[model samples]
Target: MNIPKWILDVFYSYLTSELIYFDGEYPIATPVATFFNPTKNSIILSTSVSFYNKVKCIKQNPNVSILYSKHEYSGLSEKPVVLVHGSAKVHEKDFEKNNAYLSKLIEEQKETWKKEVYIKMGRELDSFIGRRLMDWYMLRILIEIIPDGIVCWKKEANILGSVDDLSKTIGSVKGDAVFAFMGEKYPIGIPVKLRKSNRKFLIENPTLNLKEGQKACLLIHSHNKYVKEITLTRYKGRISRISKTSRISRISTREGEIGEIEFIPTSKFSFKQGGILNSIRFILDGKRRAKKFLERYKKT
Candidate 1:
């Protein structure tokens, strides 16, 4: 893996990255704190055993992609967004060994992460109360991703149809979005134009060969420079191609077909919504969920 210096810098310092993997068929995307293991030259991420769905997905299909596209307050200049196509290995059997490595990896980022969490929710993650409440998160599993290839670009090419001037769009969502579609070897994610159509969403010029009735995912999220305020929403939906004839009159007439993929969301999940009360509620709810997951883990 001959990754460039700039890309490694981003991977080493990035606060969070979006992890996309195949869940049997459709892509599932989630945000995760990433770490670089120089010894093994692998990307490392730890999650609670409670997140069985993600672990199960990796076991079912190891092909995955990690995208580092956000650059708000990381003390770094604007850099090309890096997308890593990789194969994943989940470390689950040896609880003690995995936990020790996770503990050290976590300690390295504890100050930075704790500072951000403190600013966002006025809570200390290492505090006594926090420790007691988040024990489930401490019962961890490690995900090691070995990169097969890397793609870096500042932004998506503006070859797709333009929706900048369209007055009436479809969905009611406004945030940075990462579009996921099946690639030759694995699911790939890229920054794309997101707009509304009817009650669903539309992505402009999906570049990849897509068909009608195919399943995909849209990750919509927003965050302030301070990192105190954030909101993320994930949509799992099926694709329907909007042909050239159905293209709106305002759409540009270029060489390629004026193509668009309509995303009809069949399910939705809001992982984070920033606010003092909301954060408190989320923490409390997480504690309960963690307890249940721990019980579930022990049983298995």
Candidate 2:
């Protein structure tokens, strides 16, 4: 197996440096370098001649551990370390490859140091020292963790009162689900439907297809003891008032007989009404009319 040249260089440089570890309770040092083998998917250690006896003792026991120190700027309380409770064996091929990588890595380090010296020379004396004194080295590690499932905070509220599922409906109306303090006598069971005339006039037009499973207020008009719903849909814009003027003539009829009913929009029932119920009813009607307009547009 072959590893990238750049990665091999990094591995070699890290290996040659003395690795500090904890032996029992006291800190111990190991003057060994590591080399990686692609086939084994592990790193191999090369012990120095001076530490050869110490390495032999640890190899015999085969229950040693390795600890890596954290950079001062790591901002972590625990030092990065790994433990090994297994035996070790010498691999000649791995050792040879490690040695070659380490030699090249050391050369690269020398080049980097030379460049640093040039950079420092270009800066002010005080600035150069400040840069070297700064203690901030960032270290990042990547790990993957997958969640099993989600746990909702309010199970009952989510199933019954959650507005997430009705986002489309609320968004279509340009409104969000919110709780309002309506009077105790607020009618909650009334079934309101969208109407077509609502959209012809430039009112808040919510589409009928996006009906929300919630109660809305409506304006109920009573005339001649008969309910005739006149929402933002039925008489939109100034058209209703304008239509009233187009009458040919008004003829008087006998008493107790209906002559003619003049239809006109007054300020009392117009969209400008400052009542929450009226506004809700107007919006609902506009939504219905808007839906009809869309359907007609689709057919044409």
Highest TM-score scorer: 1
Deviation from native of the Cα of residue 79 in model 2, angstroms: 7.4
Clashing pairs in 2: 195-289, 196-289, 197-233, 198-233, 198-286, 206-287
For this target, which candidate reaches the highest lDDT against the unseen true structure? 1
Off by over 4 Å in 1: 94-99, 106-123, 155-175, 224-228, 243-254, 257-259, 274-277
Q: What alpha-carbon RMSD in Å does predicted model 2 have with respect to the real structure?
A: 35.1
| After superposition, candidate 2 runs with Cα above 4 Å error | 1-31, 72-81, 91-300
TM-score of each: 0.79, 0.23
* Collision count for each candidate, in order: 3, 6
Model 1 C-alpha lDDT versus the unseen true structure: 0.69
Candidate 1 per-residue lDDT, tens place, 1-300, comes to 666666777876567789999987788888777778766778988777657789989988998889887755555675567777789999987766986785565555434443354234324544687677665556678899988766665443211122121112222211268877676668877666667777788776533456788888998877655444668898888887655432433465344444566889988888666777887786677677767877876898
Error of 2 at 74 (Å): 9.2
Candidate 1 has which clashing residue pairs, if any? 170-196, 170-197, 171-196
RMSD of each: 7.0, 35.1
